[model samples]
Target: MIRKNYNSLLITHILDGNFTYVKNGKHTTAHKGDTVILDCYNPHEYYTENGFESIWIHVSGSNSYELFEEIEKSNGTLIKCKDIHYVEKLLFRIYDSIKGDTPPSELRISVDIYKLFAELLNFQTTKSLGENNYEDTVQQIKEYISDHLSENLTVNELAMAAHMSASHFSRIFKQQTGFSPYDYVLIFRLNRAKFLLKNTDLSVSTVAYKTGFNSESNFIYFFTENVGISPGKFRKLKF
Candidate 1:
């Protein structure tokens, strides 16, 4: 059985015990360290077996559909352990932030959640294709991207990070990800922009600049093309 929460999507990191979920007429089971994606708009039910414990994040907003679509596109699903370590770390970070008595800001929390989801997507994509030395390469590339989202990222730089020639790295990356390196970067930037639009008071131009767009027009074009809405309209719809 599947239970639906119409107002919020649930990300549950099951620390222990058994879990099951059904989608598209199929059922899947998960053990400890697994994560589940419960789509609020979809009717579904799930339950824990013995010694069930998990951390759940409830996500809702006008941009929620966009987030869901991204996850779905990358084959994210319920009762999977893809990127469990990253999700587990994020859960702890969220807990720490709350327990540390820092004033809660919606934007900060939302950004963290988005990053967790993005990492999960990347993990799933990389895992399915079974690239050589995938784990280390992906981690290195992820760190490089995070550190330099404010700067221009080119295939040559990414190849250097992976210690491969530009052409070889591009081919291998596409083989592993089904997306070119640059396309992945653009998608990542767009995801960040979505978080900012929904969670921050920053102007669209400022958000674009902060997310590494060369200009507002470039940001708007890419965001609108990928996200199905202009940045200003997206912000207005969500905020």
Candidate 2:
């Protein structure tokens, strides 16, 4: 396959042989049962010395590029899938949703996309850790950020906590976590709010304050923007 100036995110689950190609001047190959994620924007082509079969889905959305860029930064275009059968099921579900009797609902489709990406992110390479062992360093950074989500945690503060310069901290952080410091804080807050909403009877306003949002409206706005539902509605999902 060859395409230039393509604009969708492609996730391919290989079935036979290997996918060999040159992407951005880097030649790589994906063996059978491995998943390959390629950003379509760059010029590339793929073929195998032997025949190959695969299931692929092209995705385009608001955050596709940002997520793909993170994956690329971590390791080129391919990542391992822990359970190839699970991936096959997911791909089949996506296919059935698109072609089955009832058209797939927007919520259902979005959920499928989320699950697929989550699987991909789980298996990406931690290349930013570089030559030395930084497991403890990264763990410290996570703990500090998790412990102080209410405070305005910036890259500088996080770097200080990890005893590294901001530039180096950010590079490693992004590789290890798939999120910038700010994004990680935002996600942490949102997830905390989700936990509160699902497990407690606190009003949305109180939850907002507890999660570091300045106002209930702002919290609701951010929650709805990322979660595709209101806090009230999401709470009902769990209950």
Best by lDDT: 2
lDDT by residue for model 2 over 138-205, one digit each (tens)? 75676676567667778898999888999998888888666787787787788667767866799999
lDDT of 2 at 174: 88
C-alpha TM-scores of all predictions:
0.48, 0.51
Q: Number of backbone collisions per candidate, in order? A: 5, 0
CA lDDT of every candidate: 0.71, 0.76
| Residue pairs of candidate 2 with colliding backbone atoms | none
Model 1 lDDT per residue over 36-72, tens place: 7767667775543334777877777767667777776
RMSD of each: 16.9, 17.6
Candidate 1's C-alpha runs over 4 A off are: 79-83, 96-102, 128-239
Under the 3 Å rule for N, CA and C atoms, how many clashes does model 2 have?
0
Which pairs of residues have clashing backbones in candidate 1?
A: 1-45, 2-44, 2-45, 3-44, 3-45
